[model samples]
Structures are given as C-alpha cells and as structure tokens.
Target: MLVVGAVVLAALMLPGVWHLLRHGLTIVHEAAHAGVAVLVGRRLSGIRVHSDTSGLTVSRGRARGPGMVATVAAGYPGPALLGAAAAWLLSRGYALGVLWLLLLVVVLVLLQIRNWYGLWAVLVSGVALVAVTLWAPAQVQTVVAAGLTWFFLLGAPRAVVEMQVQRRRVRRRGGRDESDAGLLAGLTHVPAIVWVGAFLAVCGVLLAAGGAWLLAAWPVTGITYPPWADVPTCDPMCPSAASATAPGLPFSVCDSEAVSTPPEIEPHSGRNESLSLRRALALLDVCARETDPTGLTAAEIGRRLGVHKSTVLRLAAPLLESELLRRDTTSGRFRLGPGALRLGHAYLSTLDVESVAAPSLDELARTTGCLTVLTVPDGLQSRIAGHRPAPGTAGRAVPRLPSVVPLHCTAPGKAILSVAGTALLERAVAGGLRPVTPRSITDPGELRAEVLRTRRRGFAVDDREFDPDVRAVAAPVLDHTGDVVAALAVVGPAARMSAAAVQEHARSVVLAARTVTRRLGGAGLGPSAAAGGAAEDLRARRGA
Candidate 1:
C-alpha cells in the first residue's frame, strides 16, 4: 500500500513539475518585458497571456521612441535571469531548482523567439553547469559531506544494480544481454575534464558582460553633461513633468521637477456652464451603458460631443490622470478604467432586488430541472432579471435572461401582465406587440383571452410562442406587499416536456414558487390554489 501510494503521488507530482517548467518561462518573459518598459520610462498598459504559447505587453506609445532602444534589447534578460536564479539555487544546495532551470532552458529553445541567439547562450550556460555537477565526483571533507552526497555518490552504483536486474530479466526471457553492458560502459565514461572546461568558459563570458555593463555606466553617471541628459530637458512643447523618468534615476543631478503656476481669476461663468457639465455627464452615461466605450477614439468622442479634438483632450486630461479612462496604446482606443470598475461594483453590491429574487429562481430550477428565467417589467417591454440553467444541462447554448423579449409572447412577460391586470395588458397592446415568433398571439382578442385565462389559472404557459422548440410555464414572483416584482419560469425543449411531465411537475413547481414568494414576504397562491376539483384527481394519479 505504501509503495502504491508513493507511485500515485509521483504520478500526480510529475505533471505539476512539467507545467511549472513550461509556465515559468512565460512568467519570466513577460516580467522582463514589463521591467524593460518601465526602465525606459514607458508606463505599462497591461500584460496579456493569450495562451500557453503566446503573450504580449502593452505600454505607453512613447516607449517606441528612439531613446528607448533598451526596451527592445531587453528580451534576452528573461532567459539570463532564469539562469542566474538557477545558479543561485544550486549554490544554496537545491536539486529541484537545478531541474527547473534546465526546464526553462528547454522552453526558451522551443519558443524560438526572435532573440534566439541570446537564449541559446543562456541555455548552453545552464547545461554546462549541470554537466559539471554530474561529472565531478564529490570529495568528502567530513562524514556530513558524504551523507549529503548520497544521490550523487551512489547514482552510478544504483544504475549498475538496475542494469544487472534488466540483464537477468532479459536472460530469463531468452532476450539479448547487450543493454546492461552498454549502460555500465556509459556510466564509467570519463567526461569530467570537458565539463570543467565548458563551465569555466561560461563563467568567463558572464563576468566579462557584467564588467562591461558596470564600466559603461560611468560614462552616463560621472559626466556633468551626458548625451541622454539633453533628452530630459523640457520645453514649452514638452511638459516639465515629462522629464521625470522612472524611479531610482539620480534626481539630484537633474533639476527636472516642474513648478506649479497659480491660476488666473476669471469672471463667473453663467448658469449654462452647470447645464453644459450636466449634459456632458449625461452623454458619458449614454456612452458607458449603450455604447462600447472601449472602441471610442479621440476623433469619435469629439464628433459625438460636438467639440474640437483639443477641447476633448482638455476635458479628458483630468479623467486620464485620475484613471477614470484608459487609452490603449496599441489600438489607440479608450475605455473606462479601475475607477469605473469600483463605482460599478459598489452599485451592484448594494442591489436588493436581485438578492430577493435569486433564491426563488434557484429553487425553481432545482425543483423543475429546467431552465428557470426571471424578468422585470421594463416599461411596455420586459427585461430578463436572471436565468438559472437546469442541472446537468449547462453549456447547452441557451440564451441568457435579462434580454428584452416581447411582453405578450413570453411566459414571464404574460405572467407580469396577468397579475398586473387588464390595464397593463391594454397598455402593452397599445404599445405595439410585434410578432416575435410564429406561436406569438398577435391578435388583441386572443391575447386578452390568454391574459384572462392566465389570471384564472394563476400561471401561464408559452408553447413555442416565444421561440420555436422552447416551451415555458411561469408564475409571478411577488414582493413584500404582494405586488408582482418579477416572474419566474421553467423552460425546456418542447419535445421532452410532455403533457404528463408538465402535470407531474406542476404541483412541485407551484409549491416551489409559493415557498419563494412566502420567503420574500408575499401573500400569493400558486397553481395548486386554482386546481379546485382537478387537484384530487392529479394527486391520486401520482399516488400522493
């Protein structure tokens, strides 16, 4: 059992090891891009991992300028960083870290990015380190060193034992015995001298690069006027704040801080100023909800708002600084930022209506085992409140609720009108009931009769009326004062939803509806209340 458990644990851990090796390369690559972008004074937009095989980092467009050549040159840092981390870990006596470093080297080779030459250099360095460790037999200065070197010292002996076992098995089966001899010969092969030479070569190259980078920095730091220093000096065309580079750059040598000027007093603006701000706010509201703000361009905003591009820029400048909107450097698109997320989350978190209706809709789906829908009366039309798909039936390509559907054709829509009475039905008819589906009741008389029947029966059924092949039965989910706040429905494919199944689940559905209504502090009767004489007949058939 212990052996079995150990084997199972190894099997489980193997995949995780492989996944880490693969994913670590991606992390390092992306981190290098982000770090380089920051170093070159480009504010990062975001890093996106498209898949295991692809990723990209978006930064401020100014990073593409000539002063930022290091940004492009920085790609090699990822593999080199991985190699350095591996060396650090190996020095601290961690075997798994060495394996991870080797795996990262494999990933860099497999990716074959544009900077393959640099990656190749890093990979060869790591491979050389592993080779050196394997070739050199440990000379134990103490008993502890001998104990610590078990895996390395006994590795050859263990391989010999395993090779002998395979040979005996091959002999018993009348197979060739050359495999054991080859393994023994390979194990004893002396390649330590070659490995030591490779390791020394890698160490020398790394030290040379490090020394060059440090010595070259003196030209930029020690000089009173460096070539790059002119780039940081701001003029009227360039804002003084623009000269402020990334953190850790010497602030003392460069007087780059911008001084603020006092605003000139102006005459009081008229009442129209307040009205204009309100109109601007209203236009933003429309843009946020009705349109894809993410797709908006500066010219588009200017066109829609009937303002010049400069005016649009001036108005949006403060918002940009506060992060209310983010501009995508790649596509030059604008979108609501973290500020919008915070505000939207706060509004959604405080919503009581959805909270009251959720449990009832959940229970309806659980009891009926059919897609349950909820809708709120939005003027003459109805907007879906929420939808809960039936158990074992997720990913069935079912449309979400909260989508606008014609008031007269859908079960929840009709259920709302039924409970709201004839006035609401008359308003719906006057509002124009366009035929959405073939089963839609277009005629006023038919719709009126259906509404009356729904009121009498205490529920409504949409028989492929809203959509073909979809049937729904709904009961109005009432609120605290017994006013229908929303409607709940059980919907499924018409073929599977037979008359008998409907009848069988009718009492359970009605009971579930009543349970939710009562929980929400409403006084209402489910379908069972209107069954009258047929209730006993239905119950007896079910042996209840």
Candidate 2:
C-alpha cells in the first residue's frame, strides 16, 4: 500500500507522464461543463469527445450572459473540483463513496454523449467502475479509489498544459476560440495564459488539501509518537521544544510550551510565521523529488536545500519515522521509501503509451536492426520511457541503456531540441555543452546551428557524440497540439551502422516516429506541417 502511494507520487511529479494520462481528466472536464449548464437552467445540446482527448459541451442559452460564462468557466476547473471531492472522500475513508460517485458521473456523462464513439467511451468507463465497485474485493476497491484520487490531483494540471498548447495553436492558425481557457479570456478580459494560471492554482490548492487529508487519514503506521503527544495541551508537540522556567506561573512551562499555548507554534508575527512555514515546506519539497529517495545523502540534501546538516537531520527525523524517507543502515543514507513508489506506480498505471507504441517501436527495431528507444524530455535531458531491442541482437554486448540522456550529445535529445523555441534551447544548454566525447559539440553556437539543422532535417543524427564507436538517429514524437512530447531513436554500433545504414535506418525511424505520433492523436508529417517543412528544407539543403 505504501509502495503504491510512493509510486503514484513519483509518477505524478513527472510532466511527461501527465500528458499521457490527461485523457481521463478530459471526460470529467466536459462533464463538469454540462453539469453546470444544466444547473444554470440551460437546455443541453450535446457533448462530443474527440480523438485528441479534447471535448465539447454544447448547451442552448443566451448568447451572452451569466449562464454562458458559468458554463464556460466550469469546464476547466471541473476535473479539479471532482478530484478534490474524490480526495476528500478517500481521506475520510469513504473509498466506496468515491467509486460510486465516479460511476454516477460517468453514467451522467454517457447520457449526454452525442456520438457513438463518445457513448462507447463513457459507457465502457462507467461499466468498469460499476464492475469494480460491485465485484472487486475491498482492498482492490481501496486501491482503485487511491489511484483515481492521484489521477485527478496530478492529471488536472497536464490537461491545463494541453489546453494552453491548444490555445497557442489556435492563436497561430487564427482559429475559433473553443478552449475553456480561451472562453475565460473573453469572459474576464484577461489573457488566456493568466486564465491557465488560475486553473492551475485551483488544481494546486485542491491537490494540496486532498493530499494532506489522505496522508493524515492513512499515514505510515510503524512510527511511534513520543510521550509529549500524550500531554493535554501540547498539540502537535514541537520537535525542537526546550525546557525553560516560567516566571510566576501556576503551572510549569517550557520556553515556548504552555498548557494554554502549544509549543509547536512559535511566538512570532503572522508574516514571520508564514515565512518560516514556507521555508519548512520548501525543505520538505526538496526531499520529495522523485530522484532524491535513491540519490541524495543527508549532507547533500542539506546543501541543496540550503540548510545546516543538523537542521536537515532534525527535520528529516519525523519523515523517516513516517516512512516517507527510509534510512540505509550500512551507509546511513536516506532515500524515498515505499510510499513514493506507491504514488509513482499509481500515476504510471493510468498512462497507455507503452501499450499503444509497443508494436510500432518493435517493428521499427526489426526493420532497422538497431535498438529503438522511446524517450521524453526531462528538463535539459531526455529520459528513456520505453525501448524495443533489434532482432537477433539479445546476446551481443550492447551499451548499457541509460535512464536519462543529456540533451547536447544524444540523438533523442537533439530531435526534441529541434522543435523547442529559442529561450528553451538556451536554457537547455545553459549549463554549457559538456564534452561526452572528443567529437561532441562543446560550443554553444555550434550546438545551436546543429539544433536548427536537426529541425530542418525532421530528425537528428548523433555520430559517436555521446558514446565512442556508437551512432544513433532519432525523430520527434509530437502530441495532439503539435508539441514535441517525445522522441523515437534507433541506436547501434558506429562500424555496423554505416552512413548508408544510417540513411536507411533514419527513414524507418522517421516513419516509426510518425506512427507513434499519430497514435498519440498528433499531426503527421505532411506538406504544410512544420515537420514537413523541415524535411523539405533538409532535402533542398542536401540536394537529395
């Protein structure tokens, strides 16, 4: 159970996974708008679910009025509100209630679904919830509830990202304003980006509230509280409390602790207290990074968090007991515990990219006779999310697969970089292009020109820049809104994957990348598309 939470937690923290799981939130988002339209005395027209995970909720009402604004505003915040409700239910140990509510919502959505596909989607989702609620074991139901809660909490923001992306695309194409963010922009005379921020703020607040409640309701169980917890007025007993005599007081008092005032809260002005709390929360946030559990020592954590080593240990003590952090006995080092994995897994299970792209990537590997990897951007690098090994290549000595690849030296990274804007590209190489090999481009200007070349070519080639005597070719995987969300790469030895083989594999890699991109509800590389333009420019430049 703890491991599930930990996994979900880690997975939720990942932006890459969030895009993959944003579809579930889309259903709720449309449902929320429809529900509000009905509540506000508007006649429902219909709801349409698109292949791209975007949806439309139509209603008949005054062209411009409070009802219209309410309906438009409800769509974006719908998932967050629903998720907040679910979290509240989970925190209150009403997991069964959460399941039933989800079923009810799905049923309601099914009734309003306009098209056959939409009907099928909502019906299937609703029936699944019903089956689980009716036939699944109690523990299974609880897990489902937890998973649903985490999905709502984490997936809501990614949906917002999708909305923002859509908004940008629509602005670029001079298309109709259909997004909730776009609608809110017109309603309040605020920019769409600001509206996106408002939606994010709502989701963030709800997530924090729901997460806190759930944690308190079902926290790690092995930790024993100190005797001070038994003290009658020592609420949330202070970990740093010290004994001090009280002058002319009937009862004995510590420096800050009294029967009347809790020692856990220091006597400070409101602003000071708020600042202190923010700093403490910042420390907690530092320790909660997905990589921190297995990566950082206490001293390293303190340095990163900008606190003293003793202070870090002091603050981490309660978390350790809570099983949020586990200490390795031999090295006395700390890493995230099972709880983090639980959260990570919960978030990952909701995503279907691996299942969706497996066959395509496998085919690419077989066709190219090179290791095919599926990767997504991770800050200034690309992380391998999935891979397919080339045929009859299992027994050979291959390079170790990397969980993360640096942006400047890897084909997958360069492919993604090709589509990035100037500012983002600058940030990516801000740390300076470190040399992985003598051939690696260390100069920022050279790397920038290479990125532009990759953009023109609609793919990237890493010629032993990352690994000595190894070569790779990669293509970007676009999302529905034409955003480069991931990359597909074919990698092999420098000797065997010759210039001719590189050209051959590059075609197969580009085709495979487009296949996965289409499956993800994104645009294909056509004549008018930017990807197609790049390919055209590349061919013209090379006189191919």
State in Å the error of residue 467, model 1: 0.3
lDDT of 1 by residue, 1-544 (tens): 1222234234334645433333334444555666677777887765544333234555675523542444533433343444444333332323333454454544543343334433444455456445543443221111112121221112222223333566668879997544414322334342423323333444345434433332222111111111112112122111244344312112321222222211232124455555444434433432453346466777776665555666556656666677767779888766676876676567546655567668877877787888877778888877887788898776577665547877799888887877664567778888877887765889876676566555544456776777877777776766645577777778888767754455434434444555556556554632333343133323432441
- Candidate 2 segments whose C-alpha is farther than 4 A from its true place: 1-6, 9-20, 219-544
lDDT of 1 at 264: 32
Report how far residue 160 has shifted in candidate 1, in Å. 99
What TM-score against the true fold does each predicted structure earn? 0.32, 0.39
Taking the candidates one at a time, how many backbone clashes does each contain?
A: 1, 26
Where in model 1 is the C-alpha error above 4 Å? 1-351, 400-402, 525-544
- Per-candidate Cα lDDT values, in order, are 0.51, 0.69
Leading candidate by lDDT: 2
> What local lDDT score does residue 116 receive in model 2, on the 0 to 100 scale?
75
TM-score, structure 2 vs. true: 0.39
lDDT of 2 by residue, 98-151 (tens): 889998888888888898767867777888898988787545677787788777
